[model samples]
Target chain A: MKACKLFRAGDRPVLVDEDAALTPLCSGDEREDRQFGKGLHKEIAALQEMLYAEHQRKVLLVLQGVDCAGKDGTVHQLFRKINPMGLRPVRFDVPTVAETARDFLWRVHLQVPRKGEIAVFNRSHYEDVLHPIVYDRIDGPEAGCRYAQIRDFERTLAESGTTIVKVFLHISKDEQRRRLQDRIDDPEKHWKFDPEDLKHREKWSEYHAAYEKAIAETDAAHAPWYIVPADSKPHRDIAVAALLAETMRGMSLAFPAGDPKLAKLRVK
Target chain B: MKACKLFRAGDRPVLVDEDAALTPLCSGDEREDRQFGKGLHKEIAALQEMLYAEHQRKVLLVLQGVDCAGKDGTVHQLFRKINPMGLRPVRFDVPTVAETARDFLWRVHLQVPRKGEIAVFNRSHYEDVLHPIVYDRIDGPEAGCRYAQIRDFERTLAESGTTIVKVFLHISKDEQRRRLQDRIDDPEKHWKFDPEDLKHREKWSEYHAAYEKAIAETDAAHAPWYIVPADSKPHRDIAVAALLAETMRGMSLAFPAGDPKLAKLRVK
Candidate 1:
């Protein structure tokens, strides 16, 4: 099955129905599957080079997941073969003092991929909806307004020749607990360990509910969302690569045909 | 001699006195020099990773040169081994309608590197001063104002824990003519060929004078300018890498110390 269809969150997606451990695209042999994932990444890189040379369209990949759901790992894996010149990976942290002064989407709009570029957002404007809704900072009506604003914003980008791919890295509560425990156990990774993560984990159900609501309300044909099971890192990497490669392939990008008049021009 | 001292644009820089073809840092062997350049890039990549892990200070590299001076090539070579997650390479083109509406520095300010990030500008705010002066769009008084504004702007960034390294990729007029001609001759490179390059070539002396004025006025200890000889691509790569590596080494970046309180805490 095509990854787009295989992982697509249909009209109504229940968080409980998706199995985070399922690896439908994997060939069952771990080594072979890893190689397959690498191959897909190479393909994505080649396609990106063409898109850059074509210099016409833009590609934006949004990765959203609970902590330790492998958003960073997935990005590292996906772009291993790609040239940094053509890639823009943006990690949106908490809003700065200046950012809070402006509209929520203002900073985001500033970072959208320019023509002939591929931009990956580690966490994105989606955080605006997810965090506020989970923390009860914004009321339901305000949340609805933000969702409409996001839909309009994304539609504007799609209209301007940007292909948007939004992926939700789904991991089970058990998987999250194990990953959190590993971070706590390792001294080197203690820098990445935040006490606030425990507080957030306590509200896992609420956050999941928030994610479901955000995905359901804002998912559109132009900016499709994929719920990739991310319990296993390699599986998550493979799934994200397949989905992205498939997406870029659909763009049908090619290098520009040169001017015939320049064919005979020689360097002095 | 240290690259910092060797390429430093002194108090009174005469562009004519600088030899763009000089390879003072090279070992007089082509292959060895290329390998040495690669080694410096790796060292830079490692330093950048530490800087990202430190998550405190910021680094900004600004490249300014006439057309076909290999700005893009410098960036590509400098970042081949560095992770894109820690790198932000911004290419500033002509301002759009929205950008034109604001003060020149407004758009440039928005793209400054975030904490723990290294941002490289292929062409930068210097263009704001250089282009206008060369074209007579901004008069001497206005140019002086912009130059002072640039100095103040860079000082602000430096005070806020951003180490700025500005480099001029100095290529001879003959070298640029050959590069421009090569772009015109190769159909594959036709997409990069802009006819305006020939128009700009006619005003080479004006552009050089503008650059000299801008550098002399804005150069500071906080945001020092390096006049790198760039007639040979390998020489340019080596000088940039060495200067940047030296700058970062002075930062003393390292992984954050693990929290003592988390020593006994378990994830469960």
Candidate 2:
């Protein structure tokens, strides 16, 4: 199977074959996969220590996608290996009265990871652009301003040393239908479904358009958006793990040599 | 030097001599502490997997405290070790119209950790008893209702397998005054001080009374409050880590073990 090319759009939505056989990424390469996973886990663990010790770098992971796109599952599975001490996940919903009065980003900014900490936004600041554009909550001209505001906000965050990785979990509508149906058919899974999900499903095309535009406008060198295929859970997990591992590896962190004076002390 | 004793009402707060000679907890004696911190980290990691694999469990960590009491430092230091995936830290603030209109715990309940994930609230539901009671935001018989509501809410969480660990980072007023001065005098630490903190400092007695009442009323076996001495950062970190570790060790977990068919293929 051919490797899936990373999607980069100019004016249109980039189409991907949802059912295309996933090129065996880190899978067949078990040693590499295990090494990568273990190493990434260790590095994250250490990064967590650095975050605590120095409190210097703030990290944010933003996941945006359509229903059944595997945002929740991907986060649970891939991050399962991380220590809880350093992990924080924030899910954004409709703003409350106080939040609405502040700049759309205020509530979000307050939640940004402090230096050395990792904060995940299950759906994040992008919602300002995506929701407004899709729901006609803002006009095209207004949406343009919102998009720029988002870029500037993210730019400020990046400048402050926040490594932002935005993942757009791309899944075909057919797959969404199948997963939604699976939730509906299984009694135990019924809790996962919401009727409102269908309403959002009905406006699939609009959301897709909104997402494409949002990605195009905000994709930056500092905070790039990766459109990852989500048809296969294991494949998506492996791909995300690989992407995260690569990102951390690029950071080139060194574990602090223990304080020589403190290290020598025998506490008995 | 003796181990720090509990503070009684109408008495001076207990103070531990920072440089006093003392026996260190042995590696074997500290196994519970080591296991607690390591185990909690592992539990959180497992939960992250459960979040991904099964998408069950929303976890919430609520930290409530007085000024200079080390909420920021504890969260900064302790959670620094967890995996960043599927973890979120939410810092609760003064109630807005939407929050005020809802029951006291409404916003707190909304932020509960989802299955297989964890959410940390810098200050949480107990604030219903703490802030309101302290500031006269809620009073008289109504405050009684609020306390009962918090207990019920936490009980419901416990029944549903939501583990709640409430930590009160206890510090004496004298220590708070000293820390506040340190923040003011040290150029590098000046950013941490807010003039508004002085205003809260003035109301210290009222806040303490509120806290004592809240702790006495709401400390349940399911979600008991752990009061860690905040004057010593290392001691606090070690104690909190040990407590969290013990909590996770008690919650026995088993890895997915992979599919039996997949396991067979792996052997070849």
Q: B1-268 in candidate 1: lDDT tens per residue?
A: 8999999996576676249989899998999998999899889988988888788899999999998999988987887677788888888989999999999999999899988899999899999999888898999899989988998899999999999999999999899888988887777778888878888989989988888888899889999999999998988999999999999999888878877788788665
- DockQ (C-alpha based) per candidate is 0.42, 0.10
After superposition, the stretches of candidate 1 with alpha carbons farther than 4 Å from their true spots are: A14-18, A22-42, A81-85, A96-106, A136-149, A264-268, B12-18, B24-38, B139-142
Per residue, candidate 2 scores C-alpha lDDT tens digits across A23-72 of: 35546676766665566556555655555444577678888888778877
Candidate 2 chain B worst ten-residue window by lDDT = B1-10
- For each prediction, how big is the interface RMSD? 2.1, 13.2
User: How many collisions per candidate?
Assistant: 0, 31
Query: Which candidate tops DockQ?
Result: 1
Model 2 residue A137 CA deviation (Å) reads: 2.9
TM-score, cand. 2 vs. native: 0.58
Candidate 1 residue pairs in backbone clash? none
Which has the greatest TM-score?
1
What lDDT is reached at residue B30 by model 1?
92
Give per-residue CA lDDT, model 2, range B179-222, as digits (tens).
Answer: 87776655444445566788788878788777767777777777
What Cα-based lDDT does every candidate model obtain?
0.89, 0.66
Tens-digit lDDT string for candidate 1 (A172-233):
98898899888888777877777898989998999989988899998899999899999888
